[model samples]
Target: MDDPVRAFLEANHGAIMTTLKKDGSPHVARVVIGLVEGKLWSSGTRKRVRTAHVRRDPRATLCVLSEDNPWAWLGLETTVTILEGPEAVDQNLALYRALAGEPEGLDEYRRAMTAEERLVYEFTIHKAYGMH
Candidate 1:
């Protein structure tokens, strides 16, 4: 991610991410976008359709609308890497705070976070487009 895309992502922009289902259909969802170590990242539960889709196929796409101009947007053709373990929960926290801001329910959030199986997906951009 770079420039306007990065800036848009850093702001309160929502992302529409898509993954391929086993039947070769697209499953789309609004997701939290984050930058970890300067790379774009997203997350979801392992039991979810999107995560399962990613486990089967790494290909994905993320689209962010420019906050400055509603008509302008950026889309990325991306591949994902799944990271799991205790650190994955921590990664989820970082990604969550990136979009949702710091929550007042930190302890509750941590407890809830610890209960789920998480996949921290790092996006590798293969192509990008800025739609005017």
Candidate 2:
């Protein structure tokens, strides 16, 4: 990715993630996404339809919009890996911090994530395009 696109991704957290349904239709959701270790990351529970869709199909598209400029945006075509279980707790926390900074109640937040069975969706970019 170019520096400008990387910067745009790092600066924005709100994005639209599109996954494939079982019938090959599209499933889209608004997600809080961030750039971590050169990959795009998002946190979701296993129960969510979007999560299930990704679990079934690794291919996905992420559209990140500029909060300040309506015309500025970035679209990424990627392959996703779902990270869950005990190891995902810390990974999800890191993603949360990257997107929103330190939580006010770190321990409580961790507990909630564990209780909810949260997972991290890691995206590897294959193609990128858009106004950005």
Candidate 3:
């Protein structure tokens, strides 16, 4: 990644993620995504349709526009792996902190995650496009 691209990704920008539905259609969702340790990942639950689609097909795409300039953006075509174990919780929280700063009400979120399910989808970038 170039300097400008890396800076843009570091900012708090909204990301759009696309996954293939059961019928082979694209299912797009607005998500919080972060580039961590040279890879991209998104945190959420196992109950979402996005998770289901990813489970069925690992191929996905993520796009994020520059928070500084909307015209500038990053696009990535990736293969996703759903980490579904105890480590998912801490890993997802680490990604979340990197993207959204430290959570104020972490206890509530932890309870909810425990009640529901917290999963992290790690993305391996196969192809990417962005400006330097």
Ranking by TM-score: 2, 3, 1
Please provide, for model 1 over 1-132, each residue's C-alpha lDDT reduced to its tens digit, 9 standing for 90 to 100: 557666656663568999999999999999877776677888778788888889999999988766677887778899988888888878888877766778778888877777877768898998888773
Q: Is candidate 1 or candidate 2 better by lDDT?
A: 2
Q: Where in model 2 is the C-alpha error above 4 Å?
A: none
RMSD for each of the candidates: 2.0, 1.0, 2.0
With a 3 Å backbone cut-off (N, CA, C), the pairs that clash in candidate 1 are none
Q: Which residue pairs in candidate 3 collide?
A: none
What lDDT, from 0 to 1, does candidate 2 have?
A: 0.89
Using all chains and alpha carbons, the TM-scores for the candidates as numbered come to 0.85, 0.95, 0.86
Where model 3 places Cα greater than 4 Å from the true spot, the runs are 1-4, 130-132
- For each of the candidates, give the backbone clash count: 0, 0, 0
Error of 2 at 51 (Å): 1.5
Model 1, 65: alpha-carbon shift in Å? 2.0
Better of 1 and 3 by TM-score: 3
